[model samples]
Target: MLFVRKSYILPTAFLLSLIYLLFSSLPPAPEALDIDDREFSPPPKQNGGQIHWQKGREKHPIKSYIPLPTAAAPLPIPKIQHDFPSESWYRRRQRVNRQTAVKQAFEHAWKGYKKHAWLHDELSPLSGDNRETFAGWAATLVDSLDSLIIMGMTDEFEKALAALEQIDFTTTDATQINVFETTIRYLGGFMAANDLTDGKYPILLKKAVEVGEFLYSAFDTRNRMPQSRWQWTRTAEGLGIEPSRNTILAELGSLTLEFTRLSQLTNDSKYFDAIQRITDQMEAAQQKTKVPGLWPVMVNAEEMKFTDPRFTVGGMADSMYEYLPKEYMLLSAQVNQYKSMYDSAMDAIKDRLIFRGMTKDNQEVLFAGNAQAGMPSKEDLEHEAEHLKCFLGGMVGIGAKVFRRSAEELRIARGLTDGCIWAYDSMPTGIMPEIFHVSACDDMDDCKWDEKKWYRDVQRRLSKGTSAQNAQQEGKSLVKTHGLAPGMTDISDARYFLRPEAIESVFIMYRITGDKTLQDAAWRMFKNIEKITRTDYAHAAIYDVRDRHTPKLDYMESFWLAETLKYFYLIFSEPTLVSLDEYVL
Candidate 1:
């Protein structure tokens, strides 16, 4: 009986020990929070404010994932002028109200696009039909993705995000597309969306890679200069032929921003190398040109040489010059080459391209015109300044802010900005024309024949490299002292495509100077634009800004949303939203 009892006790004890071990291995029950505590607790901070990741073994990390800046950069608060109502409450309320209005405007346009032109490159407000300016790639939707985030349209953003899956970049054909437009509108939009989303979507990076793979084919030339357009060959082994031997400056030089970011993100040198070759070629060509910073508007892609001797900061070359200072800032100022290029270009522009003219009121106005390599002609001098060239104003202002140590640059920026404003104010509608003629201060309005003394004075100052302050003072004196003849300016091309240059400059100037006048002017101009361009479906470009009743142009450019509206939105929003100190754009 004692032996049997000992056996049963040993077996029971063994079973009890096994049960204890199993219970000990199980996870503890989650601790209940204090009843009054917030429902969603913030992540715990550790090791100097870094949020601690949840304790776990990370698994199945993807190789294509590229980490973007997850935190908002520490940037300076853009200050309003102390002279303009010192009450902080007033300014805060103003900003909030402006932001709300801009948000509503954006939503109105977006809804119209989704309803009428969904999955298309552009919206034709007049026709309510879809158009494909961007290789049939639904550019409006892709470009609008980041703008949605900026406006805090989460529901629309998610819808657009889901729609991105339908965009199949893998399918290639002989359909040619503009490389520069695609890079800026599509590639830029994608990268921006990814950055704003804190890299939540790896799909954006993947699409960029896919698109870039085909674009690289444009660089496969003997001279390493990229063609303006690209298409894939039938076999898919090689790319389609170049559209022509000649390529424009903006098309070639504006690529560095997008491609360099791609390299940094993917750790791929091929993208960087492609654009680097263009930079190398431009640097070498800089030595060959008579002007230090300026190149001809057109270059032979095959020979890697400039084919056009005409130099202008307008049309096909504006963005190239604009990108120099921006690229320097975007790359954290590590690249000095970009600054050097910008300096030389500005010097060339001041020396050769700048022209001082007079209005009918005899106000001495300074303008930038095209420069010929040899000598100026009567017809060439008569060519009107384009609305596109007005971007020079903002570019100069931004350049001054970046190169702040240089007082002369600041003066130049101010002068150019002021000149652009004058151009806008001179028109009857207070909206600058697509193109307008400027002439010497005379009743005849023939600037080409007058050969005025102010022109010679401008040439002398430019040649001497006058201090920007002195140059600016001199410009003001030209306007104040030698008032240009009234009626000397005339509208040549009255059409308005809803361009963003003048408004963009106004926004930049307002931010830098803290001048409330600029904001007021922008608001008034925006109202005018809405009155003239608003359509039943969406806004359409007008045949003329001077005529409110002008015919609709029947086409809404993709840039209308991507750049124009986006700029306006940023302009009205709180400056800290995307502080220039932090964001390169």
Candidate 2:
């Protein structure tokens, strides 16, 4: 459902009635609340634990280094003007129960990982085995540390802190490492945990510094650009490495937030300087791309040039665009380049990428799609959407509010979010697939369902050898076989990877607009995902979200705990707990 802000207040008697109907059926409070006032003991010290860089090591005295500028004021938290009274006791209790439910789910998965795959990158919930997708560095443990503290699981947080002490950044089982994933999940995790605890735990910062040094080795090239995928083993051995000639936009552009945060915390400009160079290159190339405002998916990291004409806000380019506004906020609005770059990219996205999807119910939803350089015009937008692009709604929402953009941006954000919610509801298991195709509506404001057009589109996609009548008959069978939703004609990739993008946006929209309907949408998404993905140990990814009896993939990514459940918990908890005004989260 499209979320519209509540502009009116209910009468006292009607308010009470509404509360009773809303919360009376909610499950009773659990034995314990998700949050508590418990405190944690400091973790034991490591003996001079620090990674030594073999080359390009520089030290800046605090006196000589200038700290990044801070904003004059924090972004104001938006408040609904309606005179809805303070939360009723029933509503508060219901929120606590929902938060508790999310906390319990996190605990189940944490216990499973601790028991079955401690110190590994990820846990195979179904197989009860460990997998090292990201340097075998206890990714889930580190990633979930801040989430644990935010949920008031002090004991679990303390245990995770202790486990963090045993991690060795000097070595890894994998010869090569992905710089982007490591920076976000590992470095971002440690930095976030450190920030949440008010810097009480020195070990978190220490671990972060160690990981940062290891990642910094990727930038030791002729040019300051980093290797998207680095041979860490060679770097550890003091061997030489070069930046990749062909790298995606995300790998080169997503490092700013984490690296900049590290510099702010440690007062070392080395990390920030590395990423700033990349940002400067991106800004210089902004207008040089085939699509002037947007960067292509692939680029030459060494030459710092766009290498592909294909542009998308999906897989290879999502976080690059995502980090622009976030980095602006994180840097306290001191850097105007980030703002300029973000505005340019978003303008291109709104003009060339967004499309209206014509669903069977004729729902008016907007989706961010793909574009090619040689397209005849902006109207030739690809009608494919990816789950990863769902984050755009929240990103755009934050930009709109923080930058004081027009109300049109907020409206666009709502349409984008509604598109994702529709995808989830339209699926049989109530989870959007990784990638799917939809029928395009000619007009964004005036969309209509046309079954004949859908059938014709399907017929045209069939093999050339097939007869027209046979093609039409086969199209119907294909629809049933693929479990295509009413407006959908094909399923490109149907797997669901326990992603957090959709819920992430839902949580953000709820916070920014204070919309109760977004919470309802989040609750339905959580329940459907938990029901379909849960196993005896923990939740697993599904083979296909459109299948009623889909098999489970034996995988659990760290973001499942770090982002998915964390967002769910935050949405159900008090808004003041992680107030948007105080943090860039």
Candidate that would win on lDDT: 2
Cα-based lDDT at residue 564, candidate 2: 94
Give all TM-scores, in the order shown.
Answer: 0.75, 0.87
lDDT (Cα, tens digit) per residue for candidate 1, span 245-329: 6778888888987776666567565576567667766866775774557888887766676757788888888888888877666
- Candidate maximizing TM-score: 2
How high is the lDDT of residue 523 in model 1? 68
Per-candidate clash tally = 15, 0
Off by over 4 Å in 1: 1-87, 172-174, 234-243, 356-366, 376-383, 440-488
Q: Per-residue alpha-carbon lDDT of model 2 for 1-585, expressed as tens digits?
A: 001011111122444345445543322111221223223323223345533233332121111222233333433334322223478898888888888888889989989998999989899999999999998889999888888888999998998888887898766667678999998889989988888777789998899999998898787665667888998656554456778878988989999888887876775656876787677788888999999889999998877778598999999999889888777767656566888998999899998999988888887788988999999876677788889999999999988887767899999998899999999999989999999877788888888898766765555543456677676677676677767777776778999999999998988888888888898898889989989999888899999888879999999999999999999999998886666665776
- Residue pairs of candidate 2 with colliding backbone atoms: none
Q: Please list the residue runs of candidate 2 whose C-alpha ends up more than 4 Å from where it truly belongs after superposition.
A: 1-85, 461-474
The worst-scoring run of ten residues by lDDT in candidate 2 lies at: 1-10
